[model samples]
Target: MHFKDLFVNVSETLSFTTILLGVGYLAAFIVSVLVISENRSPAKTLAYLLLFFLLPFLGIIIYYVFGENYRKKKLYRLKALEDEKLQKRLNAYVYQRSEEKLKENELQLKDYEKLVRLLTYEGRFPLTDNNHVQILINGEEKFPVLFDALENAKHHIHIEYYIIEEGFIVDRLFDILFKKAAEGVEIRLIYDDFGCSLSKKFLKKIAEANIRAVPFYKIHIPFLSNRQNYRDHRKIVVIDGEVGFVGGINLSDKYQNEGMNNELFWRDTHLKIEGEAVRSLQLFFALNWSFCTDEGLFFQNEYFPKYEHAGDKKVQIAVSGPDSDHASIMLSYLSAISSARKCVYLTTPYFIPNESILNALKNAALSRLDVKLLVPGISDSRFVNAASQSYYEELLECGVRIFRYKKGFVHAKTMIVDDVISMVGTANMDIRSFDLNFEVNAVVFDEEINQQLKQVFLEDLHQSREISTAYWHRRRWFKHFFESMCRLLSPIL
Candidate 1:
């Protein structure tokens, strides 16, 4: 029983244990790499790989919690199949009608034919005429119109929002919804579980009041649910299948400047549509409702009731989500920017653009088109803000004028091209909105509305501070380093 012999034996045992741990880490890393690569982009794959390599145990836990590929899940696959079937059934008829309408007003829509065709063929969004669109500047203007439409709901009311915090505005909206429900009006609601975070009692109260409320992709097991990353970010309100509203303004006090904190002011854009265009929003709601509740409600005639002619604006609803192969809304923006013959104007809170959109903006600026982008001077998320600023130098170098809204947070996600096309929606110019969240935008092909949007953009510029190329280049070294780090993580942000 010599001490030297015992020491040698202990050293050998410790070495064996270390080898076993190394093998386990290698196995976990390999499995994570395989699973994440199924649907993630190269940038994301590399980021996750680096994460796992740096911290094996923690990265494995993080990947299991957040990096699960929901695209490979059967639930989303089934939903996509259902959407495709519905689109296939209606696309041909819609395309034919759009073509006929274009021929009838060839001269008026001639400039927008290519854009219309792009949305139709790629996004499967059919352009419909005889629609009316009202540009709502912020929640101050939008809420009143929305409340009036809700108060006038005769048949049914449908609402879907990412965030529906309990507040003054939400309480008012709930009271109205309850009143309408009591009056024999059918009410359906879909709110995101992560975004809304309402208690069971609140949801039960709404259910007891005769409103069919459902949480989108409900998280049955809390943190165990990988579906948290794919949120239903759309803010939609449809009344009697005739009038609808969509935009970035969620149902919360923060959206309204009066209800907001004294130091904060909310700036956003929403659209009020009446006519056949409302049907597209209705369809989006119905499909999402069906997916969330597992109910075959898309065939209900009440949700798609025939509409009387409202106005003469042509509109289309472009939707994108994890269920789709391509980022339809992002592509729509890229197309609009690339097709701009006069100018391109855009406003968004998050300006983290993907390669395609960045290239489009650069090319548009290089072509001497007046390209302008407005972002918030102060963002809610510092990392996101830094990532947004990281692109300022490149865009400014290419002749793109960048402005930061100093009055308040510019939460509006809008784009206007050539004074002929305008889009307002929930999608931001970021990877999360384009690839992860379910978003819908109203694509308007009308000169009048586009001009109005252009005017609004100009007014916003008055409240913003323009970032000159020289100023961007002269940023401090530490600031550049911090922004570069944020940009590195922007792909997965």
Candidate 2:
């Protein structure tokens, strides 16, 4: 064939391939727009649209893998229905008692009553009194009490954790669990598959011991499932439905500084609760377990065994996740911050705040409320750290004192407002914790516990280096540029 004929054939083939590619891109873009338009967040929709238009093929793949709204998918509707039924069953007696108690102590709890009602009505969290709470500072303080509770459990033990790595602490806990299971005590354990990378054999071993161990939203094909992004980040352990533990510390050695690993000293906080509050924790665990395994669990008297009055502390267990339209935990935080009369103190490992929380903090600071934040000096994620730092200047300018914990990584997700209210649990100051991950927080309205947490905050402050407005503004140009880039991706981070 002649050269001219060959060139003409090649050009025709290229034209046909280009037309097909253009049609494919158009199809993908239309599908993306149709799917993403259902959500209410304009910023997130715009972000998705921009990514689709910029890189149609890869962007669609990424969105399919991580961007699907689990709430809209109705992934946890069954669990929610079960929860509603349980709530209805308990509503009559629980609310009546709660109201009577509130009226009796109206004068003392006047300031925190609104918050209690908010959680009760909006978050579906029950406010209960006659509870005892102990604040555990770190793993060193938390493990011993947790182990003792496990050893003493007489009935059933329920545990749900985000991460349960293979380590000395976990092994020790597992031994106790195995022994308890062998003793005919009911044991049900739920761990997030994405967060806990334990071997299948390990899970099988627990199952062989007659313990019901299930993974929360297990990934069947890993990269293909959108559920990988939404994790059960709660760390809860209910022993015999009487004593319970909840907080930021997972079952791992990193949380403990035994001079074994080269990692920095870890700081965290957890709570041990006894009395009616443990019933709430037990309910939370049962609901989550039912969600993960399709097991029908109902509230029974056995799970809420009558206990002697432990103390006079008031506590509520606030939960939030993608199952609901409202971010309950974030709303709770906003309520606490807005209601602050004297001060707001918080410590979190990640500090990527959404616009509402950011604005809340800024407004609180501008109002001359002593708003303070303690974050890690060295973060685990570079992108998250940069995104967190990007907001430092704005918060600092608004008089929100920001502190970088220099002694170690401050992993405690805790808050204290006006020495009247305290919150400690697994929710971080990030979008994921508020919207994607299932999180639980203990909201305590006891002045004694609040003051104790406040003192702990002051001690943490002594170890943290305050970030000055001038120093934050003096960052290098490249660093600012990088942070700005990371901030743009903060919505999905």
Candidate 3:
């Protein structure tokens, strides 16, 4: 109990605490340096830096889980190589004619030639002719057509989706799949592990039915799974290499509004493509299948059968993800907006665009282009909704017209630009879709399809409440501040 002894003990405790603090700050500094070295966008780098410094150990955990800018290329490199080999083997004729098609498209589309070429080089998605594209609105139209296509699969059926929730719709889907399997038609399915909840019993049923199925980037533990950040968000269906479907609609009952009383009607868009475009969809599926199952489908002639002039529509498939060398979908969107000579109409469930897209819309509006955006009034995530709203004031100030759909969630990710192109696919106007997830869009370059999508967008406007600058600026100050705060973290959201 000596006073000198007590003083020594307290000094030792203080020394330990100081050493711990020093080590923690040193680790945070190292991580911050690494984040900067990743050469991420300025906003993302700053957000991650703020998190690392402000929250101490917690920030380190979050960054470890989600912030590391790791590309999935190493895992997908084989798929990429296989795709390259396949393209050389099967598409030499298409590539040979691509220049001629480019010229034809340049003359046909006029201002969209640059956009077409950008996708050709950047996305590695060749423009194809002899495509028949049908714009399917909502699940009501999509399911009937999809079921019929599934029922008619003579060779093989490849289905991939982010969600395949168990419901009557999925039950019916399985029934058809089982019948197809029994009929000796090859069936393969890929579902996102993070997005779908496939019961063990249901998975057992899938196995028993002799239908090959796998989950993309399977996660065992939810909390400790860092791979959950990168997801396969594409919804694609390729049947017999003749028919294909791509869009935002997942294989879930909620996507269909039939027989619903109080449930929110999910507004969405899908493309039913029959022609050369189906080969592109099948190509993506095969690449993803190779990644997930290590099974090469590159040489299957039935999976890539020759088509005999299905229609006259021209279509190109745009796909992007961490595996991609560039953010192809985002670049395509930027090109579409920048190439808009008259109007830019966009409808999305999420609207957390990056700096380029945000500025592109503002610039288009400032140039007196008729720019319109339709977003969801009732978003499933409040954080995403608030962050989306934060961009509106600036857009409105620049004379951009913004509308909020009131009837239900407008989950359609579609854009119509100047009656030249219509884009419908899974990529949202957000950082997640642009950079993190696997996404695909069918870009249609037909006047008929463009006009149809434009008309649908106009009809959607009737149900959306347009936001006036006066009305937006008059909102409460706290709401604005909260939205701004959320916007600051949007790059990583």
Best by lDDT: 3
Tell me the lDDT of candidate 2: 0.86
Error in Å for residue 143 of model 2: 0.8
lDDT of 3 by residue, 150-195 (tens): 9998989999999999987899899999999999999999999999
Listed per candidate, the RMSD to the true structure in angstroms reads: 3.3, 2.7, 2.8
Best by TM-score: 3
The C-alpha stretches of model 2 lying farther than 4 A from their native spots are 1-28, 78-87
* lDDT of all predictions: 0.85, 0.86, 0.88
User: What does candidate 2's lDDT look like per residue over 147-244, in tens digits?
Assistant: 99999988899999999999888999999999998898999889998899799798888889999988888889887888778889999999878899
Clashing pairs in 2: none
In candidate 1, stretches whose alpha carbon ends up further than 4 angstroms from where it belongs are: 1-28, 35-39, 77-88, 259-262, 298-301
Which of the two candidates, 2 or 3, achieves a greater TM-score against the reference? Answer: 3
**Native-to-model Cα distance after best TM-score fit, residue 192 in candidate 1, in Å:** 0.5
- What's the CA error at residue 29 for candidate 1, in Å? 3.6
